[model samples]
Target: MRKHFFGSAERLHLVLMLALTFSTGVVDAMGYLGLDRVFTGNMTGNVVLLGMAMAGGTSLPILRPALALAFFMLGAALAGRLLRRNGEGWSPQTSAALLAVSLGLWALTVFVLLAPVQADPTLGSTVTSALALLMGTQAATAKRLKVAEITTVVVTSTITGLASDSRLAGGKGTFWQRRALAIALIMLGALAGAAALHVHLALALALAAVIATAVTVTGHVAHRRAEAEAKTGAESPSLARD
Candidate 1:
């Protein structure tokens, strides 16, 4: 079936995206709980929270969400520019972009280490801005890559698709694995990150950085294997997935 593929490259890409999705949950928990009640991955939540704060329903600060929206827009714009220049499937340029986001998270980890001691120690606007910008870039890049259900950052539409397309609801059953995996990874990351944060604030971001870097390394390996196969007059399995 078209919905399923046997190519190793596409399967690797999907697995990498799931790792990044887990990182998204970790970073988002960091942002929402640690960084002034802002959401780094899910801009929809930021928008709604901003509106709620405006209407006096929630106590979240409006500035952080506003900054998240602005920074995410800028990040997405940058990712769009990069994608236009990339002009191919799963190019190195896209890997570079993903790496950049992870590097930003590592930078945030340093900031956390330097932070002053406090009882609650909710982070500041800078952490929120850094994470939001990268998440926006990540969301855009994932969308361009066209993974079936692995958006990596946001799960709202995935949830909607899951419910709206079920056989019980009289719609074709598709994306069951991708959608289920996406949801599960995010939840797992959130739980893991939340537990880790209680031990050390920077540990969550560090873990996220590790997962994101692993994705990049996996891409590099796949790309190298594809090149080798090409030179050997063999069909590149990785490129086939592309």
Candidate 2:
């Protein structure tokens, strides 16, 4: 189990994806509170809100959710195209860095040119669309990584996994630890972002981008180290045989 854990790319990807999930939570909170009542990452929430607005059950603008949903699709489309071109050469870190850098720039623009930009409904919508785009691209790219029971954009399945895979549920509970961590990290991120909003709403996105960038660098280093370790292990076995 130790060798499996150390040798497997799945474990590394899962850890990094959990970080991305936390970033998603931060940005989703930023979108809902700071932007127009939209969820930049969680499409489930956006869909429900869109339905309610259309049903006249809420005062929320339909355009907000519609725009967020549209931009998210656009982002997913962009990721699909990039995936086709790069094939396996493209790593999750690459997509994450793309998103973090773009969002970082957007956050800077909001800070510099559009301080308190959320008060301007039109500009907020535009910014929210951009944020949703990054999130959707990230969601699509992360999906390609093929980790089980965890998606960075939402935790419905992760929660389900945590419940269903528990030892009491007649399952081995193998992923309970990671599943629980995903939920915890997302919740922590939500709390952090909401608190930062009281100070400066843009800080949420900035924090999320910083976390993404850090994970991107960390994943690269971890991948290199795993490769080196695997090579040394392979060589040691061969040397002993020789």
Candidate 3:
């Protein structure tokens, strides 16, 4: 029997990535709304906010967004360096990276719960930076998974693809299902995050952390199962020849 509705491991990776896409929306919402107008996951939004801050004439923060961008790049660089030797698709490195993201998010969640960002500027900045770093790590790990157009962090390209590749655009509308799902999931995640913030920032971070943990565990199990099945298939072929 197939292990999932999308039977292949490759398709499973796409679904896993879509989950992370949702988590990214949650993280971004927490950052933008709770953490002083910063974006932890959506670097494109962060960049634009940074540009506007630099342009002057507003009380918009410059330092926090700038720090978030820096830490995010650092996280991506570190994750990429760690994953450089691995080939496409999930690996031990992918699991480790995701686990690290999970841990980081949980740690931030606890910290926020203990020291509410509204009470301390330093803590707020620290949480914001940490979230950015974790998000960057997640983005890199998802990229390594190579689930095609599902990048998990930003949906701009997915939107563009959905529109540009539509039947109205004189092209065969392929992969629209995943693309549309990615877009919708991110939006829903953002809504969830915002709603959670009405209660507490920690709740939002905790939700993201939980999703990260789930993704890490599920992906690792699926990868191991796929590897074992391949091994069994190879052995069966040799045994048949004998």
Per-model TM-score, in order, reads: 0.88, 0.82, 0.95
lDDT string for model 1 (1-242, tens) is 11223366677778888888998899888777766678888888899999989998756689889998999999999998888766545787788788888788788888777884224334577778878898888888877777788889888888888888988889886987788889999989988888877987688889988887787777766776676666765556666878
Error (Å) of candidate 2 at residue 26 is 0.8
Better candidate by lDDT, 2 or 3 = 3
Cα lDDT of model 3 by residue, 18-52, tens digit:
99999999989988998889999998987898888
Q: List the global CA lDDT of all models.
A: 0.80, 0.76, 0.91
TM-score of 1: 0.88
The C-alpha stretches of model 3 lying farther than 4 A from their native spots are 1-5, 240-242
Question: Comparing candidate 1 with candidate 2, which one achieves the higher TM-score?
Answer: 1
TM for candidate 2 is: 0.82
lDDT of 1 at 71: 97
Native-vs-model 1 lDDT?
Answer: 0.80
The best candidate by TM-score is: 3
The candidate with the higher TM-score, 2 or 3, is 3
Instruction: Output the lDDT of residue 51, model 1.
Output: 93
In model 1, the runs with Cα more than 4 Å from the true position are: 1-7, 117-123, 234-242
Error of 3 at 140 (Å): 0.7
